[model samples]
Target: MAPLESVRQELSQQFPCRKDQIQVLSTLFEASFPSPPTTVVHGLEATGKSVVVRAVLQALDVPHAIIDSKECITTRQLLEQAVAATRNSVHQALGTGLLHGNQIKCETVNALENHLEKNIKDVPKFVLVFDGVDRQKEAPMTLLPGLARLGTIIPNLSIVFIITVPNPRLLHLPGTPHIQFPTYSKEDMITILSLDPQDIFLERVDEERYDYGEEEASEDKAWLWPRYCAVVWDSIGKGAARDLRTFTLICYNLWRPFVQPIVDGTHGTRDFSKLLVSRRSIFQGDEALTGKIISAKPSAEDQNNRSKPTFLELPYYAKFLLCAGYLASYNPPRQDKIYFMKSTERKRRRRGGNAGGRASKHRKIPRHLLNPSPFSLDRMLAILQSILIHPVAQTGQISAQIATLTSLRLLLRTGAGTADLLDPATRFRVNCSWEYVSSLGRSVGIELRDYLAT
Candidate 1:
């Protein structure tokens, strides 16, 4: 119930430098009240760029106008909205509606210039924070020139434009200062987590049924403490600092239901088994480990099954992981237990097809893979099935494959594959053992015999 302390802490850590920047600009603005504005802070999303500007304004105790650049419906709409907001905020603050009575019929850039020149007469210094600038249709290139021209027309109108975007390089704004948003380090992540109140942490602990048994409690401080750290770390590593807010929300959601029941006396420590099962359910379904083993047979309707599954058609992240795993197997210094790649030769042998068959004319090679032509996903799946049944390969190899397959299943179940999998920036790496993989496959209704026989 207490306001989140981390937000405040993050603000405090960022405001000092930002305050100095605002202070200098404020001084210049005060000197140029009847003249043009000066300075602009611009950067991408989650970079604390907007936060810095807002914090500065707050510290200065000076009134400023903020235009939420994300609200526009289209490129033209964006320009219109921005100009309108700028004029309205200035008009409201200065008690003068210089451009209010007349319908200023002009282009976005020109109109904004006209409003600034005509309306900002004799007023003291003020700043404009343009958050969500990337959401605009155009890069505000026209507005920039207009802004520059204002300095000559009105010497005292010192204006500092703060533009927040996801990509700074694309802006091409001249004479503007660019700031890069830093990625959150592990220590930063921990600090962010620590900002949560003691009650929140306790609630998460209780909800997850994280209490240790008498024997384990005496031996260690927390139940599954290492596992907890790994999970939190993994979540944070999935994206940049902007994602921290979402990561915290996920933790809160995961912990909320379990803790509330305990507090209400509707649940107790004896119900830990159910809580454990529930937590597992959040990540993976109740699928047998054997289900992950790939198997293939000439289908009863084989004539209709001409299309092969290609890796290119797969989500980008999945393809990247599969490729990384395949490459890792041939190479060394692997992060996982063992990476696996299904041999095309083995698949041909199992299907009684020629091992030296000509490359298919229709197969399209993905741009990332240098190969002239790439095997389809169905073909890859078939090859994987063959590897699962190979006598020369250890059962552990097959098991490991099954585990990777199971992780993929979990990703799909969580709907993570829909977006994250499609993103080129996202990738997956499984650290599970073969035994666990085999166990997971069985849970999902796959049989070891099917894998071995095929």
Candidate 2:
């Protein structure tokens, strides 16, 4: 085991967001150094189990052998590998002549214990690290229990088993002191991810790096790197499994799309924040820049002239279904049309048509300002069929499209209501923008310009 101070120092340098784990592990290593009770370290994948344990052991300058149990097929193979690793470790540290022979075969537990005791006499203790013990259990290898009993079987030797299993009972090794590493919470993840140097590279890039007249009053905010890293974690890291390595990898990959242009002056970074928030600015551009050229002789060429919306890539029927749902939700019924009427009767006198409802209902509201209202699935389907120019949309096609939309969160099912009691009725609401809905409608030859408020 290593000195407590040095172990803590190494941990702080290499591992972040695991102060509690590091503290406890440092104590364990210090107390168990030179000789150990069987120690089992288990946690979720990528929780830094192997890294922490190995770091502490190395800090203490212990003679240790690390082997992955995954490569061992049987008890014999495990024993051979562990003994070989231990032999190699001892041979390197103490040189030749320490053991009777350099080649020590471990065919039995007794022979292994005898070999370890005789060969590892030079070091204060010998650490045998078995990584991926869960794999060894699956191999049904009979070596784990024996290794767990190493404290009594051999003196001056300790065994460490690293696993991903949460329950120590699963390993069937009773009385072994097991150290559990919990998965990182979102806040913990953010803290750890913020410390990564991936985002710092962008801030410190040669061309983009700026110095404030004084350290405290620099035009570049000191918080920019942390804030940027936080946004990345919130945008992409949170959705994935809480693994530091994986999160850092995602942030690394995002540097080009999100940070490169800003550094290269191809695009400005001031307005770029979250992925979705800065999407148009980072990827899309002004209408004039993206507008397609029109041909004087138009023959089936109009489709290519208009700038297609992002949702244009959706399946054909999914597009029409979204447009129909949008109309059904945003456009009120004929009787309630006065609610959305452009002018009141008093105002119409200044203009034209006599508004015939509560005067309050005739308040002018822009179509674009209207929020999507929940509508029955049947009504949406009816609108879809009526607006579809092609008869290819069959019942199966409609059902499949609705399912797709629901999965994509473009259509959401609301609570069921009763009226005629015509089976289990479902209600749905369009969950996207008027611009997107209108684009879909236009793509399918249905004019949605009149249906939307704006």
Candidate 3:
């Protein structure tokens, strides 16, 4: 299959869209004929931006090229490539007679204008499909002016730019009108997964069954159905559903031989630890194991306290999550607390009190110590440390960082452990402190802050 066809097939299987959107884009392509005007489609990653562009091209039966802006090392390089490719393709289709003695000059905006002028004088219409437009670090701001100029200079030449980006804030570019692709809903995700090639799904199902004994498999189809559904739901919720490639990877990992054997024998509890380890490896690789050891190792204070440290080498991502306070105890005994923290003072007091005195006096109630709630400075520091130490190549680490940052700002206002932390005045002060600290220091920027805070 052609590259675009394969991409189209993948998109058709994974993305949720109304038939009308596909029809409209298809119709637009069918009607298109080497036009100079451009339409821009922009959205978050895995939201089907490139797929829509490819679908249109396929429907129109036109040969087009797709380029990723992010992969370009510099703006000038990207512009040079885009201009050269566009000029070469157009010039080839419509010979020198249409050139009218005009040489194509490669000044960013001027080149685009010159191309558009030549196209109008020459070919009926032409399309240039630019994918990953927003990914160019500087092109959006620098090259957009020339692109906008095309609207007035060469109305006949059509351009379709498709951008898949993580930040919606980037859409504020001048003269670029874009259609945003929203994140898929749970129902939409389910529907898309159901439509996935049966063979693919069955492969996952078969892999999941490898550890099951024949007798056990015969008795519990009902239980297995929910397990499959849960896996699908979790996979989608975690952002794997957006891209078929990633989703397939998730399925392969979830039902891999190593995990299935454990799942088949036990009621999923044994699998939890393995799942955590696997997820860490998937997200962090060797770095995660290193982070786990670092986190599990006894802290300096733990050594002085002479208590068995509760810290165990957690998965690096889990440690990151815990540090960011994303993985808080569900319905903790104290609403203000995040994780359970052992109190050295209480332990000391209990040891001293137990030495003598009335039974009641010696038997003082142990005070429970819980980690301060999410958004505490301690948690933020822990998360930041994990990110700094862990390898940066992990998928979803950046998103996880951002989510943690958002959670931190909210938590700071609530105070780490103080009951008075709920006061509006205290919360406001905490927010201001976060803003001030983040603005003044690179270590506390929004991205880092979010990772730590969460």
Candidate 4:
């Protein structure tokens, strides 16, 4: 048997902040034989519940079969597969595969019990783990309680159920021990994430060391990474990041960009507040914080190059909404009919005859150069309908898309103290830069210059 301390240490290394759970599991499985009929490791998703249990069982060289009940929804299929898996797991550990017995078919709870009683009861020791047992096509009313009491019938067998929900009453196993894994706290998250601090820059270019390890990187490791995680938690993880898996993915996508400015000497290593201000766009908007990372792996050359993020793809109607919002915000309301309205009237051009007036003395600032002016939703929609080739979609659907844009911070809602969402007076302004909207127009094959009034 592996030393208890070594096994505990191994588990601690694999899963940090799980010392109590590890201690309990080690004590439960490490003994020669066990008591309780069932052990449940339950918690919210991605809290290291299943992984931690699997690690501890492996550390002690325990023979166990972990069946994901989620894969086979049917009760009969689940029962048969569980039997087959249990047999394979036990025989492989016992080196009795050469003398394999006839396969037993178990479709119902009664038959499953009979098979386990006659065949599996004679085994020295065994464990069966069911992950996500609540996900069954057939309601698992009797099967759960049946397995929960299976240990009394077969002393050699121990059963474990790994679940994501916190409803222990559903099991109805009174004496069973429930090991719960709660969602990680921010401090715990920072500690866990900082365990493996990734290097920002890999290559040594032009004599100035770009290491996050020796001098600057040590600070980056100890100081920068934690603050960055705290910022991420504040922006998105507080609500959207339900699990560590998704939270980790978001961090990975933003980490490279967050550190690029520092690597370029645009900001100092100690200017954390400034760094956050500069990189606000990357995390401040719902679009960046909730968006998925591109799946394509960066090439070696591309990875070496300091590449900035490109434009993320938007929905088709969303493109039109953005373009229309830009036009409505920047162009004067007086010129709306001239550019947007369909007409055949030609007007005479203005002659530069040196007219003497205060207007001529003062050069008027271009509308595009000034801050965006708020426009009514109806006017923006009218502009959108005129430009779009396809018929304007349902009003509710369009409204929902506009709300999505607002949440993304692409468009700012200028209305306040208003309860009616569809009020004619509700106004919004484009929150994007001129160059950005120009690029968006190009992508959609629309020349924005033709529609401009300035």
Q: 1-454 in candidate 3: lDDT tens per residue? A: 3444454455455445634355445545554333335566766666666776676565555534455677767766665556656556666655542233344345466765665465446545556666776556755464654554565556455567676543444433355445567655555544555553222122233436466444444344333433443454563425434554455445444444334444454435234545544443344322212333465457798787876423233334433433343323211234222222333322211122334664544443312122433344343443344435543553466445434444555334454544543222332112223333333333322242322312
TM-scores for all candidates: the values are 0.42, 0.53, 0.43, 0.60
Candidate 1 lDDT tens digits, 286-312: 121112353324465663655632221
> What local lDDT score does residue 450 receive in model 3, on the 0 to 100 scale?
28
Identify the superior model by lDDT, candidate 2 or candidate 3. Answer: 2
Mark the regions of model 1 whose C-alpha exceeds 4 Å error after superposition.
1-44, 74-76, 79-83, 95-104, 138-153, 158-175, 196-231, 234-242, 257-454
Clashes of 2: 6
- What's the count of clashing pairs in each model shown? 38, 6, 21, 1
- By lDDT, the candidates rank as 4, 2, 3, 1
Error of 2 at 402 (Å): 46
After superposition of all CA atoms, the RMSD between model 3 and the true structure is: 19.9
How well does candidate 3 match the true structure in TM-score terms? 0.43
User: How many angstroms is residue 396 displaced in model 2 relative to the true structure, after the best TM-score fit?
Assistant: 48
Task: Please give the range of 10 consecutive residues that has the lowest summed lDDT in model 1.
Answer: 329-338
lDDT by residue (1-454, candidate 2, tens digit) is 4457777876876787777777776666564544456788888888889888888777766678898877877767777777877877898777653344455567777777887787688776677888997677335444566667776677777788898874545545667677888888767766776554343233444333653233332323334545565666665566653586776665555555565555566544344454346443432322221224743346665666555444547888888878878878876665234322334642212222346743453557665577777888777766666567754545676677778888889987777564432222677777888677776677768777644433
Per-model CA lDDT versus the true structure: 0.44, 0.65, 0.47, 0.78
Error of 1 at 190 (Å): 3.9
C-alpha-based local distance difference test score of model 1 = 0.44
TM-score of 2: 0.53
